[model samples]
Target: MNPVFKEFKEFVNKGNVIELAVGVVIGGAFGKIVTSLVNDIIMPPIGALDRTDLSGLFISLNGTFYQTIKQAKDAGAPTLNYGLFLNSILDFLIVSASIFLLTRAFIRFQKRQVEAENADKICPYCISKISINAIRCPQCTSILEETH
Candidate 1:
């Protein structure tokens, strides 16, 4: 095999690189799901309350009025699609909140794992793992007492 190809293969075979590739794929799918949730599930009620269709909101730059964005586009009028911008902002917020929640949950899980692994008490004098009920440092033969 060519040396460059060999190096490329090694790079691609790395665990981090593989994990990153998987993350990218999953992130794309997750983004679509969040976008749908924002557009389909969340926005309709808010739009209804405001008596506005957010995705159809825009201003025609041609100094002509159109009932909707589609109408303006069909009439060959330039438009400032602020309603679509609002939808994009909503998508961003939803994605951000979802990532925040997942990160917080992952942190909590990691903390629990660490605590479980460190459940056994360590002897301060000998720096060895000791039973939680131990009254002496077994390795150094030092008496343990309640200092506080």
Candidate 2:
């Protein structure tokens, strides 16, 4: 095989490349779900209670009062959609919090794994970490008790 292809194969075999790609795909789908939750489910009740549509909440630059964004756009007027900006801010906060929680959980899991691996015995004489299965301390060459 070619050297470049061999190196590429090694890189792909490292596992994280595929996982990262999958994460990206899943993250995109999650973003869509959050967007739908905010726009379709969460905003409707708030809009109803306030007696106004959240999506249409905007300010027209043409100094004309419009009931909805549709009216402003129909008149060829530019608008500042502060409501949409607020929605985007909410989405960002939700995603960041979720990612932070996931990262914390992953770190905790990694620490548990490290502690499990460190369950090996420590040599009494030299105080060096040794395998639990060791019959003698490899560092100090001291005899160790048997497992029976």
Candidate 3:
């Protein structure tokens, strides 16, 4: 086998690469959801306010006026589509916010689990709840072993 192929094989076998592949697949699906939210949900209200479809909103600098975006593109007219840019920005913001919220919730859940585990420490003889660092079991008066 070529040295490059050997290195590639090692890279593909790594846990991080597998995790990243899974993340990419999930992110792609998440992106489509965000795109739909931006295109269907968010833009519709904005379009109603502006009295024009966001996808149709554009400015052609040339004297030639286009009835539609396709016509403008076919005519090779220079144009600025601010509405599309706005939609893209909204999509990015929505995706970022969702990922941020999910990560925060996961962190909070992990912290709660850790706290619950800590609360389970008990005096061996008395069966009463006790701090992990207790020198002796307060209820039973038994010596505590150093866990560390």
Candidate 4:
């Protein structure tokens, strides 16, 4: 194999690298789902309630009136698309909240796993931490009798 190809294979074979690639793919798909949710499900009722089309709300800088953003852009007019900006901001907030919740859940799970592995008892011989279910002190190799 070519040196560059061999190096690339090794890099791709790493577990974390594969996991990261899967995460990026899933994140991109999640973004599209959120975007569709915002545009289709959330925005219509919101726009109706506000008595304004959220996506169409923009200020024409060229002093030309246009019914839609497409018309304005097609006419070669500059516009401040604050409505699109607002939509993007909403998308960012949703994604951020989702990532935060996922991270929090992952942390809680890790804590549970650690707790199951490490316990409150200190081994008398070595003064090292051991699991509640342990039959022996791992550090000192001292046999233990269940107090309970």
Query: lDDT values of the candidates?
Result: 0.89, 0.88, 0.86, 0.88
**Highest lDDT among the candidates is held by which one?**
1
Question: Residue 125 lDDT in model 2?
Answer: 91
- Residues 1-148 of candidate 4: C-alpha lDDT, one tens digit per residue: 8999989888888548978989999999999998998899888899889798777889999999999999999999999999999999989988899899999999999999887665567777788877777789988899988864
Pick the TM-score winner: 1
TM-score to native of every candidate shown: 0.82, 0.68, 0.75, 0.79
Give the candidate order by descending TM-score.
1, 4, 3, 2
Clashing pairs in 3: none
Candidate 4 — number of clashing residue pairs? 0
Residue 74 Cα positional deviation in candidate 3, in Å, after optimal superposition: 1.6
Rank by lDDT, descending?
Answer: 1, 4, 2, 3
- 129 Cα displacement, candidate 1 (Å): 5.6
Answer with 2 or 3, whichever has the higher lDDT: 2
Model 4 TM-score relative to the real fold: 0.79
**Residue 19 of candidate 2: its Cα lDDT?**
91
Residue-by-residue lDDT tens digits, candidate 1, 1-148: 9999999999887648988988999999999998899889999999899988798888999999999888999999999999999999999998999899999999999999998777668788888997777788889988887533
